[model samples]
Target: MDTHFIAFVLRALAVRLHTNRDFLSWYEHTKPDFILCTNFLGGSVIASIAKRANLKVPIFVYAADVFNNPKAGYCSKIDRLFIPTELGVKNLLSQGYTKEQVRLSPFPLQPSIQQMEKLSKSEARKLLGLEDCFTLLLNLGGEGIGSTALVKQLIKNKLAWQVVVVGNLSEASKQRFHALAKQLPGMSMHTPGFVSNIGHFMLACDVQAGKAGANALMESLSLGRPFLINELLHAARNTQTFFLEYQVGWVIRQPKQQMITLKAFAEDKTRQQRIEYNLKALPLQFDSDQFVNLLLNEVKSLAD
Candidate 1:
């Protein structure tokens, strides 16, 4: 979208590719209007590339997460830093970045409001071949870890529930989960690997158990699925706080604690009801469109 929008603004724009060997030479020859870098690439690499190019083009950095430790080495080279939330902006200020250099930019989804349709729970379950019972969707991100063992233990305990594991799994992990699925006769366990229809699966289940990635959290909220955040490393506690503040999910303190919580949720109907109430109260709407617009405007301002 950014590339297409830029093309729309500029007439007779010629795009070129520059290899590492000829990057400086190409930059000197072309002298492009502006340089925009996404946060995933980090500020250091962008700064180095711009300095080596020896071009006066304005450099803009878009940070998707909170900048807890912002130092001069990272901030000095960036002309402007685009952040996702007001919390991010405050974090930047604490790191000594001037207000002028910081801009609020949120993440955007490809699908618009019209595409935000949801399937009924029964319809979604039927489509996915899930049994008509209490189901839990366990998503361990791209790397499917702790799934095989977790499902096996859940089944061994003879819990009246369905376990569905989603995401990419290694060959060994796949075999293990498959064996467990076969062992548990009445307990229907399914492992549909690397599926694009995540929304369907999310809507089919009563609750979600997974890591606290921002994208995953937002998707769960958008689908109105109550999530159980797995225990994370100490460094990632701040990131987990975002979900806690919104009351969309509960955080597990450890692997054993996760199992205890799940067991309790399954047994205690009152606790489950309270959790469902909190999940319904969470805000479904996100400011992704506003973020995209701010980013586009900032890019245009820099280009002008």
Candidate 2:
């Protein structure tokens, strides 16, 4: 939020803003120590404005995704860049940015649940109306793809497990899933679209199925849930590396192949147990305090 950023700035140092007619008046009356923009406009636009104003204040561009695809050309005009992960730093370096210009930071999570203790599986499942027996939760980011067909096939095979889809789904897609849910009596299917308490859902279920968005993947790992990631996204390589490093979960290129293996795994209780054990053994690697401190320090350095 703007207010949150403003509060952070005020705590660190003096902050001021001038706009519209007041811009000229403020520029004439006072000189700024630094200028910071939260990527509100394009980097080139910010650079041009600074040039036209004859301001020498350093401009720091806080980028969340710029490093992921540096060819997007948003980092050229900024004095420095702040990225969320070491992976991001590597990406920037590969794109020709010097090491000194890039700072590693952590992505900020909502304060409400960052440090909150995780709930027990049974307690979490009970709250979400999920069965504690055998269930797989698929979180395909915002766009739920290949999961409906996979769930239907799993039910057709008479697997004694429930499938819960926990992302955005169209009404038609939901209706189709509901119909399949009726056909498969032993396999109850629930598509509760977009719940804020997704952490509880992640904890309640045995597995996650989706593309590797950093937010969802981190949450799944934090809750010790094995994930089945789609390997089509640009972040797939990074996700694969993380999973391999941590021994967290499996990755599949084709959804059809994943479904075939999932069907087999669903029927094999021993295999599922083994997978869960491995997931539990994986250590937590995300550190928010380090992330925030790094970002603040970088911003301060740019100001200096």
Candidate 3:
């Protein structure tokens, strides 16, 4: 009766039945010392394939989400499991992994994002030609799911706050936002659909709103911007605690409610300063080089 259980069973059956001759052939041809994988499904498949190949290759899996399933015994096949948060490490430990079997690593931001120039609030606003007023960044992942509702609330309430919405919005959604932009002439509504320089946009805003996805959360914190999370996936469920515990942000839903909080937050400069300071204090962001070196050192140690 449980949907998750049924889905898990179907996936397990598929994993058992799945076979890729090309993958196996390629593995045999290349014969790497070890394998590093990003997701559980791929890691499990690679582990099964490696065992079938009769190779003593090590497999490392960096869990993209906090794996709450303690019964996921397939993870034992992984030589090392890397988790990004202390809460994740706790979850895996409770999942029966040994101390040596798990490694705690910060989620590494993309090189472009990490290396981007850190701009002051005034400098960032100037670069984007944003008004020196309360600004909010609404980026609900690539699909831009919750953005329209929030923007409508802002328009209906006649709020003059600046909004920067960045996502791969549908054409219809773009037209809708364009029309709405005309209604709120005082507000600076920037709907730069699907931008590459998201870090710059983030720096220009006082707060970010979206799903508590791994990348979005890390990117916001890396830029020292507080995140107003509305949705959470299974993997991101633990992130709520991180936000609450650190006084960095709040988890609120409903466009009207979010607007109310946004208005209040905008007026409270001391609170904004506190949240920004807290965001900067968290040890969440890492560079690409550090991530690569960490993996390389681990592989060398295993080889030795």
Candidate that would win on lDDT: 3
Off by over 4 Å in 1: 1-34, 48-56, 65-73, 110-116, 182-185, 231-235, 266-289
- Give per-residue CA lDDT, model 3, range 61-128, as digits (tens): 88876423223434456688877777778887876678988888767788778888999877888998
| lDDT, candidate 2, at 234 | 58
Q: On residues 1-304, what C-alpha lDDT tens digit does candidate 2 reach at each position?
A: 3233443333223113433235445655776655555442444344444555666766665554422533443444456766665666787678666888776655555444477558888888888877887778878567765556667566666665777887777788778878887876777778897777788888788778877776787677667787887554653456666556655676886656777877767678888777778767654344567666765676577667
Which prediction has more favorable TM-score, 2 or 3? 3
Clashing pairs in 2: none
Candidate-wise lDDT, in order: 0.64, 0.64, 0.75
Q: Where does model 2 exceed 4 Å of error?
A: 1-67, 143-147, 235-237, 244-246, 263-290
Q: Report the number of the highest-TM-score candidate.
A: 3
**Count of residue pairs whose backbone atoms collide, per candidate:** 1, 0, 0
- Return the TM-score for candidate 2, rounded to 2 decimals: 0.72
Q: How does residue 122 of candidate 1 score in lDDT?
A: 91
Q: Is candidate 2 or candidate 3 better by lDDT?
A: 3
Per-prediction TM-score:
0.73, 0.72, 0.89
